[model samples]
Target: MAHKKPGGAQWWIVAAFIGPAMLAILIVNVYPILYNFYMSLTNRNGPRRFPEGMYEVVGFDNYIRLLTQSEFYAVFGKTVLYAVICVFFFFVVGLSLALVLNHPAIKGKYFWRTLLILPWAVPTWITAMIWRFLFHGQFGPINQILRSLGLPAPNWLSDSFWAFVAITIVNIWMTFPFFMLILLGGLQAIPTDIYEAAEMDGASFWQGLFAITLPLLRPVALPAIILSLITTFQMFNTVWLMTRGGPRTLPGQPGATELLLIWAYNQGFAGQGQRFALVSAFAIVVFFFLLGLTLLYNRVTNVTKGAYE
Candidate 1:
């Protein structure tokens, strides 16, 4: 295919249409990122004893500290763990649900769909707060229920491992509706004739699913899955709300629930003068990690090349 050059008039029209969008993208999305990048090289945090420290131009000093610190490494590891778990389960659970919800004979489908989507409709911060109360160590509904049933009720927010598990479950619950809706749309778009043909071939449901349905749905859902993964990778508010990063003693780390976002939050806001630049450095690292993941996903899935005919 030959690239056609846009003539002068067309270029003007293109700019006319694109001008507002580009402006919005820059102001709303791109500027903050660049600002953070610039801030990453400064020392923006300290005690009142060092007011001069705020404006100090410490080139890559923050980045050096973030890279060399064991606490930072632990946080990064936790972030990766959280992202991996949430993305994996979110994909599986969301796709499975979307498949089931799209079934032809499912009764009260609209009602069920609406109910399923309700969780997503609620503000995530509010949901997180609610779940936090439900998972409270003393009077939480979870423990109460478990106790009533004569079962062990693990501390959902206290223990480090369980806190991660709880975070994953919350994330999965919060995000499944999006996947359901996307997959539902994809499933509806699939050609019925293909399934009919599989039936004619006496193909089992599983065979048809693997051979036809998955390949067909990939194109529609792949972008959504990628997007969800990206968002979940940078997840912050839910876990923060749930535990306030939790009881400090359990993990024996510098902070509780040592995910990158939370760690950055602690660094930026915790004790004295906010370490905005250090936080920015950590944020920059996370941004690259997510960007790398997106690039890898695109390469593996050929998402940009148009996967479906």
Candidate 2:
């Protein structure tokens, strides 16, 4: 059959097929980001403060103010630290589980793999809520165990340090299985001959792991690590449900467990006054930071180039 020209009826037919999806993407994804940026440039706090048309365009005032605030840097540093810790554990735990499961001597591989991945299979929100109960100061199972053992049952969700630890554990538990699955696939793709060669060459278990397994796993693990880092940095639901960014570490400051999103959330909704513009500015800053992170990761890793290459 002869090929049709790319115009007129053909273009309309193509548009007819894709127009709804494109429009939906614009409305659902693109519009919100653009609106948030717009909101960031204004002083729209709330109806009481701005009163619909009363809000004024403040140029870069919100960004300037946010940048100048010490709290912003504090929260940002805390967020980065949280992400780093979570990702580190995610990689370590996942890789360990994957390596064990990949071992030929391991028994019940399928069963153990399925059991280990249950956390990832469960809905994160449900897990967060369940963990919240588990971290309860009194009646929770964790504290109950501690009390029964005559150990100090520190308030997990109320103490500043423990609250941060609680949220970190929840996030790590909910996410590590993802890394396990990815790294496991990478592990399986490796040829047995490579390890056999290493063994013959007198490389020890730890040496083989560091020099061969880890290096080979990089292509698969690096992308997952970067993605998890970004996700953990912006994570809100798990942390919010577990601690709501409390308990306060200092007066008139962000809570100890307040990652970037949680702080922005409190600023916009949970605070005495809804600082919409400020939160929008916060969102914009976070968006750019994440974007820069992704770009930098891709630049260094060439992750987008190809997995095998």
TM-score of every candidate = 0.84, 0.92
Highest lDDT: which candidate?
A: 2
Q: TM-score for model 2?
A: 0.92
Clashes per candidate, residues 3 or more apart or on different chains: 0, 0
Ten contiguous residues minimizing lDDT sum, candidate 1: 45-54
RMSD of each: 3.3, 3.6
Best by TM-score: 2
What's the distance in Å from true for residue 264, model 2? 0.6
For candidate 1, write residues 137-239 as lDDT tens digits: 7899989999999998998788866787788888888988888887888788787999998899999989988999888887766777777767776777887
> Candidate 2, residues 1-309: lDDT per residue as tens digits?
346775457787889999999999999989999999999999988657656787888898999989999999999999999999999999999999899999999999999889888998888789988998999998999999999999999999889888888888888888888999999999998899999999999999999999999988988888889888888888898788777788986778999898898888888888565989988998899889999989977875775446564
Question: Model 2: residues >4 Å from true position, as ranges?
Answer: 1-17, 300-309
